[model samples]
Structures are given as structure tokens and as C-alpha cells.
Target: MNSIDKLRIVFMGTPEFAVASLDALVGAGYHVVGVVTAPDKPAGRGMKLQQSAVKKYALEKELHILQPERLKNPQFLEELQALKADLQVVVAFRMLPEVVWNMPPLGTINVHGSLLPQYRGAAPINWAVINGEKETGVTTFKLKHEIDTGNILLQERIPIGENETAGEVHDKMKDVGANLLVKTVNALANRTIEEIPQSAASIEEVTFIKHAPKIFTETCRIDWNKKVSEVHNLIRGLSPYPSAFTTLDGKTMKIFSSEKEIAVPTSEPGAYETDRKTYLKFACPDGYIYVKELQLEGKKRMGVDDFLRGYKFN
Candidate 1:
């Protein structure tokens, strides 16, 4: 048998993003021993329990699954050890303890959303888009003592369209990351890959490195006084979830899609200029952010035209 076929792999992930990587490993004929995913939690208006995307995929494959309430729990650790995994593949899973990640013989590998030593935190993709980056990609690296400060195994770069939202980038990244994981695994199995430290990924001893931190409510609020490009980037970066919002007629209006016009605004920032039929544009300090799609408080999301057709100004 081949070296890749002989080693036992444990796959750990929770969300849809991780499912892509797990599926790629299986499709490439890896001997994944067991799957570890988050416990099912109640969701939706009905509050019925919902299985994570990873768990659903595992069930379909009949793979042994582990859903521990806590990673450091004695029983979970014992069960993980029982799998006899040589390597662990982690995607969108929670942070792992040393006892868990350090247990496997070959060590744990993680698929991070951004290139290492760059956006190394919880919300990499969102931050990249918010910052108006032209290029960003995924990194597969070994799990070490620190979070994403691991040695890099493989990385693949992708371009970000001028107006692409975080959700759009996310869809593209999942597939790209999945393919890279398979390549990383095969190279490791063949002993052909040379891992690099995150520090070496860059040349200059720069003062600041970008970090991806969790987004909060304040981060999602729209500041109409910023430059047009900066404000547009913020809107795209947070689109389709926790959207960028501004107050309109004393109601919160969350914008999902917009186009920026670089024109000196006649009205004050955050003021609206609309024809009551075709367009709704909010003024910024230096330009206008024309809304294409949005959701108002207590109303369903719709095109700006559709929303304007029925709504009245206060």
C-alpha cells in the first residue's frame, strides 16, 4: 500500500466551509479515520435542533463522528486517542487544546482563510474585503502552540473583484481551499513538501501586520463621512450578514449592494437623495453611495426600487 493509504487521518470541522475540505480528502481516497464536529444546537424560529454541515456529510459517509461539548473533557480526549489517528486535519473547527492537537503522531494541520502572518484570526475573509485588498487567499499550515502562527505548508492566492462581497469571496475560497488541502496532504505523504515559518513569508521587517478580529455591532454601522471607496468596501465586506447599516427616517436600513459615485455631495453626509421611483442614494462627505439592494427594519430585503415603491419618508 502507498504511504498515504497507510496513515489514519482525523478530520475536524464544523461549518459548510470545512465540509468542502473534508469532501476533497475523501474524494482523493484518504483514509480518514473519524470526524469531529460541533454538537447540534437548536436554531431557527422553531428552535429545533440543527446538525452542523460537517456532521451531515459525515453521516452520509457513515464515518465515526465525535461531538464533544468541550475539547479538554476526559472522555472526548480518550475517544479521540482511541481513533489512532496519525494526523489531524482541521478546517473551520474551534480552537484545539494541546492535549488534543498534540496527540496525533503526525501533528494537526489547519486550513486558514487568509495567507498566514496576515489575516490570522477569526474573521480573515471579512477583514480582507473590508480593507479593500486586491488579493487574498488560503493557507494550510501545521498547528502549533499559538493560533495561526504555525509553519505554512501550502498557499494559493486569488484575486478579489473590485466590488465583491465577503459572501462571494467565501464561496470561491471554500473550493480553492478544498483543492489545496488535498495537494498539501499528498505532498506531505510523499515527503516532498518543505514547510516554511510564517515570518519568512514576508521579506521586509515591517512595523505593522494586518490582523483579523471578530466583527462587532459597532463595526457594522455605516459612517457616511468616510471616503467613497472606504465606505463602499465596508458595505461589501459585511454584506449578506451583519450588513452595513445607516439610519434612514429614524429606521435602520441595512445595505446589501451599492455603487459609489465620486461626486461632491450637495446634501449633508447620511442624507438621502431619491426620485421616489428609481434610485436611493445616500450622501457621503466626498461622494454618494447609491443603494441597489437593502433591508429596512421591520421590512423584507428588496431592490431599492421595490422598497421605494411602497415606502414613504418620515
Candidate 2:
């Protein structure tokens, strides 16, 4: 057998974003010995236990699964050690302790959403869109103690469409990251790829590095007082989850999609201009943000026209 065939891999991740990478590894005929994911947690209106996307896929594949409530638990550590993995691949999983990440002889692999040294944090894709960046990419690197500041193994650039939402970028990135991860693993198994320090990778640019911290509720509030571009980017950055919202008639209305009109608004920022039949837009300093899709308080998400059709003006 070849090197890759003999290499035992332990896959670790939780969300749907991580599923693609695991699937790609399995599809590539790698020997995945174990899958470590988050424990099933109560969720939804029914409050039933919900399995992570990675766990579900692992179950379907009949792979050995482990859901540890705490990474440092002795029982979990012993069980993990028993897997005898040559390499551990992590994507969208919780932070790992030294014992866990340092367990495998070949070391741990991480598939991060953004290029290392840029947008490295809990929410890379969201911050990239929010910053109105034109391009971003995936980076596969070794897992180190210092969060995402690991040595780079492989890199792939992905362009961000001007109006793309974080969710859309996420969808694109998962697939790209999956493919790159497979390539990274195969090269590593063959001992063909070299690890480059993040410093070397950024020396060519040496630009001001941008970070992507976790997004909170305050980050999701739409500030129409800002310039139109900033407000629109904020809306796009948070779309499809914990969406950018503003007060409309003393009630909260979440905007899922919007179009920016670059015209001076007659009304002050945060003021709404709706036809009461079709369009609904909010004024910003330099333009208007036309709401294409929205969810008003106590209402289901719908097109703006549909929302306008059923609502009465106060």
C-alpha cells in the first residue's frame, strides 16, 4: 500500500461547513479512523437533541464517532488516543487542548476559512464581507497553540462578489476548502509539501492585517447613519443569520437582502420611504438601501413587495 493508504486520519469538526471536508477525505479514499464532533444538544422549538452536521455524515458513513463535552476529559483523551491516528484534521471545531492537538504523530491539520494572517479568527467570512473586501481565500495549515496563527500548508484564492452575503461566501468557501484540504492531506502523506511560516506569506503584501472576531448582537444592528456603502456592507455581512436589523415603526425589521442606490436621500438617515405597495427602502447619508428581502417582527421572511402588499401603514 502507498503512504496515504496507510495513514490513519481522525476528523474533527461540527457544522455543515466541516461536512464537505470530511466527505472529500472519505471520497478520496483516505483511512478516516475517527470523527470527533460536538455533543448532541437540545435545539429548535421542539427542544429535541440535535446532532451536528459532521456527526450525521459520520453516522451515515458508519465511521467511529466521539462527542466530548470537554476536550480535556481523561476518558475522552484515552478514547481519542486509542484511534491511533497519524494525522488529525480540524475544521470549524472547538479549540483543542495541547494534549489533543499534539496527540497524533503527524500533527493536526486545520482548514481555516480565510488566508492565514488575514481575517484569522472566529468569523473570517463575515468580517471579510463587512470590510467590503474584493477577494479572500482558504488556507490549510497546521494547528498551533496560538489560535489560527499557524504555519501555512496550502492556499487558494477566492474572489468575493461585490454584493455577496457572508452565507453565500461561506457556501463557496466550504467547497473550495474541502478540495484544498484533500490536496493538502495527500501532499502531507507523501511528504511533498513544505510548511511556510505565515510571516513569509505576508511579507510580499505587508499590508495592514485585518482580524475577524466573533459577531455579536450589537454588530448586527443596522446603522443607517453611516455611509450607504458601509450600511450595505454591514447588511450583507450578517445576512441569512442574526441578520442586520433596524427599527421600523417601533418594531424590529431584519433585512436579508438589499440593493444600494447611490443618490442623495431627501430624508434623514434611518428614515423609511416605502410605497405601501411595492418597495421599502431606508435612507443613508449618501444613498438608499432598497430592501429586497426582509423579516418584520412577528412575521415570516418574505420579499419586500410581499411584505408591503400585506401590511398597513401606521
Candidate 3:
């Protein structure tokens, strides 16, 4: 098929992570027939319904959009069918019904945040950083019966820097995945692509097959018994999101940035060290984590210096 005569595409995604790929597709001249995002729901203190990032971008691009409360709803399915899309592209979206994913002639291709066969789940970016993997990447694959268990189309590896947070890696992956999406689309247009089964190799051989399950309050609590490096990774992995937290002076404190201190420590694990004049550091199994950025319970985010001026650590 000619580049201009390429198959129509239906995009499904909900968050900002997926926005880059969606924008890239439109900019690359692909015919995005429609977009499917989550329904707007009440958020924040005012409790106003907020549209998804994908929905907002789709509106600006003037593309048709669908925000079905349930994927199995008949009206939503009918509207989706009306688009007559030849292919579907999924990014950071929820699981789809078989009827929906199987509707497109070319099948649904998902832009997974992690390089497939690893970190396969709802929060790939966070898990990669938490697991201390030196490198991570994005993958384009055909959606199949199982979640993220698809035939691989293309993957581009990106290295994780030392002391890097998951948020940083996330931004980089967004750009890399966007470019990879354009490449995959062009290849599909020319029929030069091959889909490789993910099961061809044993799972044991996959070095970094970590799960990126959804984050919760309990999961974000700092485990001081763990090695300092592990605890450090945990803090950065969840930074600026469902952040890693601990209790201080009977109040919850979220830690956004920290530095590992290798010096010998006498304090027990979970004990904190601070001077009214300068800094706050928590003792872990191996060393100390000097918290440089944090937010105390019921307080706004602030630098260590600012936090020290008003709050005294015990």
C-alpha cells in the first residue's frame, strides 16, 4: 500500500505518557480515524470531572473520540465500528474486550512502555527503576489474548542513568516511543514488518521480567530494613507520583530526592538523623539516605533547607 493510502488507525490511551505517541502519529501523516480514552471523573479538592490527557489532545487535533464507561457497551462498540478503522493503536490504556481489539483488520498494536517480555503490567516505568535495571526500553507489539503478551514488532533500548528517577526515564521513553511508533507505522504501510511470537524463548532467559503492578499507599512506604541502595531505588522509582514515604514525629513525610551516605552509622534501621541547622537523613540497613526534597504531612512540597527552617526532626 502507498504511504498516503495507509490503513486507518484508532488510538486507545488515557494518560500523558500516551500523548506523545498520539501526537507523533498525527504529525507523521497517519489517518487517525478515532481515539478511545477513559471517561472523565471527579478529581481534586473541588471534585470536578477531569478529561484524560488523550481526550484533551484528541479534541485539539479535531479527531473523533470515544469515552465509553464500559468497553462492552453496545453503543460504544457501534460507534467504534462506524469509524471503519483498519488498525488500532493502544498506549497506556486499560484492557480491551476481544471484540474491540479484534475488530481492526490489521489487529491492535500496543506501545508498551517497557521492552516487552519484561516489566509487563500497568506501571512499567516505575518497576524498571525500582528493580535497579541499568537499561530499559519501549516495545511495539500486536495485542493478543493475554495482556502485554503480544507478537513483538519493534523495540528500542534506552539506558537508565545512575541516580536517575523513574520520572526522568519516563520522559525519555515518551520521546523514544514516539519515534518508534512513527517507524513502525511506516514499516506497516510498506508491509515490511514481521511479528515475532513472545513465547519463542523461555521466560527464564528473560533477564529483567519484573512486574509493574499498580502502586498503592502500602507499597510506597519506605522499608528501612532493605539495603540502602534498594531503599534509594524505591524512593526514586515512585518519586513525584505515588511517592515513597515514611513517618517522622508522628506525621507522614514524602521523600522525593535523597542521597546515599556510605559512612558507618550507629542508629538502628528506620531511625532518622537531623540537625536543626542543616539536613535530614534516615538510617537504612547499609547506610543513610539524606533526604534533599520532601513534603511533611499536611505541608506543601519544599526543599530540605526550607523544611528545616520550620520543622525540627526528633
For each candidate, what is the lDDT?
A: 0.93, 0.93, 0.90
Alpha-carbon error at 106 in model 3, in Å? Answer: 0.3
Which scores better on lDDT, 2 or 3? 2
Clashes of each: 0, 0, 0
Q: If scored against the real structure, what TM-score would every candidate get?
A: 0.97, 0.97, 0.96
Model 1 C-alpha lDDT per residue in residues 1-314, reported as the tens digit of each score: 33878878999999999999999999999999999999999999999999999999999999999999999999999999999998899999999999999998779999999977889899999999999999899999999999999899999998999999999999999999999999999988888999998877545632357899989999999998898999999999998887899989999989999999999899999899999999999899899999999999999999998998999887
Model 3: which residue pairs collide?
none
Candidate 2 worst ten-residue window by lDDT: 199-208
Model 2 C-alpha lDDT per residue in residues 187-225, reported as the tens digit of each score: 998899999988785555547888999889999998888
Clashing pairs in 2: none
Among all windows of 10 consecutive residues in model 3, the one with the lowest summed lDDT is 201-210
Candidate 1 global TM-score = 0.97
lDDT of 3 at 62: 97
